[model samples]
Target: MEQNLQYFLIPFLNWEMMLLIWVGVFAGIWVGAIPGLSVTMAASLLISFTFSWDINSALALICGVFVGGVYGGSITAILLNIPGAPAAIATGIEGYPLAQRGEAGKAIGLCTTVSVFASFVGIIVLAVAAPVIANFSLKFAPRDFFLLAVMGILLIGSIGGGDPVKGITAGAIGILISMVGMDPSTGEMRYTFGNIYLMAGISFVTAMIGLFGVSEALTQFRQAGLKSPKQNLDRIIPSWATFVKYLPLSIRSSLLGVFIGALPGTGGDVAALLAYDQAKRSVRNPSRPFGTGAYEGIVAPETANKGAIGGAFIPMLTLGIPGDAVTAIIIGALYIHGLKPGPMLMIETPHLFWMIVSCLSISSIALLVLGLISVKPFAKIIEIPKEIIMPVVIILSVIGTYAIQNSVVDIFYMIGFGIIGYFMRLYGYATGPMVLGLILGPMLDANYRRTMQGAEDQFLPFLQGFVTSPISLFLTLAIVFLVFSQTAVYRRWRGIQ
Candidate 1:
């Protein structure tokens, strides 16, 4: 225990490590607030330049970036209706509406508070229950993962706005678009019509930038002369009563995020969406109706995504498995630094584990300070005139789309998606479902195929697996509950309305 204490204090004692962590957090916030500049990309780029740095220093920096980036993604989602990352998509559903109502400052303050609380929750879980959680997560099979994806698909009903039919249609279209690449199992071409770009599959990030950022800009152009909302920056921070009201929800969603993040191949995006759906269903007396600035909606997703930062590190430290893309890059960095990252990693280098926890702890504190300081400025952005801001949004969308791969073709694809999104919005179709579909489509397809192949393509065996495995059975039942909960009968029984 004394040795572990010493390990945890390493970063606190080392001025260089402390400075690097704060710098990384500051840089990560801006980077993550920009579309296409993902935390994963930032970490990967840092690895290239910091190849010669001490492993402790490099890991400290990466840890700070990981924590800060996840929180920063929500900033634009709130003020501009543009999610810097997919994890923040659910945040925009409620946050943007708040911004339109000129409550951006208050909304952001609450988000920052809950995000820090959730980050610590995830860290505590990582410190205490990481090995157990990592081992349990390994019990999840392909069938279970497919069922999880199916559960995610059911969220279209929750996030689909007022039109269920339109939402389903948009989601179906997104799934079709996701199928435009070569099959992973067999090298068979899918929807590619002899086009080289289509063969590589559509990047959801490009589609996201177009559908959210560009589509929002175009929609604003329709009401070009209308003045922007005058944001009220007073009382940015919530009261103790307000924080207490959301405490239970914050704990639940944060725990949910940590567990989901501990699962290999899943990350904050999935956790945030699931938390949003859960909050929509469970929160009885929200500050406002969902999709129009419910405080619960912001609390659930922001906390979940922030908690996911710590959850992501769980499997990486304990089992040598990456919980998300950023951790995967960190794994590579570990290798580059001549350190082995696997089951025996902790035993061999115990200080690395504790030091990371310390770095993340400090980073979360930095986020609290920095995030609150920026709330006023970010809220002022919502007060900008539509004519000026819309064009800037469009320009940023184009640049972000191109940065994905430096391909001009992606720009065209983005523009096309933007136009489609505009038409869909005109017709009352919610674009959230389509983005959700794009995000979960490949997971559903790949996992289902893997499960089927495991059963030798026998339909009976495949079906039986759902009942035979405990994990699969639980997930199947949860999916059933999710679908049933959407029915009017269920809503009536629960008196949800």
Candidate 2:
């Protein structure tokens, strides 16, 4: 215990390590706020220059970026209708409405506070229960993963807004679009149509930038002359009472995030979406109607994504597996530093594990300070005239899309998606369901196929797998409950509004 304590204090004692963490957090905020400039890219770039630097310094910077980047994604989601990351899509559903009503400051403030708290929750779990959680996460099979995807698909009703038919249609289209590449198992062409670009599959980030960023700009052009809302920056931070009021929901969502983050091939994006859907179903008396500006909507997703930061580290440190994209890059960094990142990692060098906990702890504190300080400035962006801001948004959207692969074709695809999104909005069809479908479609396809292969192509055995395994049975039941909870009978029984 004393040795671990000493290792944890190393970062606190070293000024250079401390400074780099602060700087990384500051840079990460801006990078994450830009569409397509992901935390994974930032961490990967750092690895190039920091190859010869001390492992401790490199890790400090990466940890800071991980925490700050996740929080930064919510900034644009609230102020503009664009989500800087996929995890923030649920935030924009309610946050943009709050921004339009001049409550951007309050919304962002609440987000910052809950996020910091959740980061600590994740850190605590990582420190105390990492081995146990890592073992449990490995228990999930392909069939269980497929069920998880199905649960996510069922959320179309929650995020789809008022028109269920339009939402389902848009979601179906997104799934069809996701099927454009070659099959993972057979290597057979799908919807490529002999196009070289289509064979590699569409990058979801490019599609997201077009669907949310560019589409938002085009939609704003319809109300070009209208005055932007005057933001209320008076009460930026939430009171103790307000925080206490949301304590229960925060705890529930953050824990959920941690567990989901610990799962391989899943990350904060999935955690945030699931948390938002759970909050929507469970919270009976929200601050406002869900789609208009519910505070619960903001709290659930922000906390879950932040908690995922810690959860992601659990499997990475204990096992050799990378929890998410950023952690995958971190694994490469470990290899470069002459350190193996497997079951023997802790036994070989325990200092690395404790130092990471320390780094994430400091990063969370930095986020609280920086996030609150920037809330006023970020809210001011919403007050800018549409004529000036919309054009800039469109320009950024194009640049962000091209940056993904340096392809002109992606830019064209983005603009096309933007136009489609605009028309969908015009026709009262929500774009959220489509984006959700695009994100989960591949997961559904790949995992289902894996499960089928495992059953030797036998229909009876494939169907029996769900009931035969404990993990699969639990997930299957959860999916059933999720569908049943959406019905009028359940809603009435529970007195949910």
CA lDDT, every model vs. true structure: 0.91, 0.92
lDDT of 1 at 48: 94
Error of 1 at 286 (Å): 0.8
* C-alpha RMSD between model 1 and the true structure: 0.9
Candidate 2 stretches greater than 4 Å from native: none
Go through the candidates in order and give the C-alpha RMSD of each one to the true structure.
0.9, 0.8
CA shift of 302, model 2, Å: 0.5
Look at candidate 1 and tell me the lDDT of residue 33.
85
Per-model clash counts, in order, read 0, 0
For model 1, state the Cα shift of residue 130 in Å: 0.6
Instruction: Identify the candidate with maximal lDDT.
Output: 2
What is the TM-score of each predicted model, taking all chains together?
Answer: 0.99, 0.99
Candidate 1 residue runs with Cα over 4 Å from true position: none
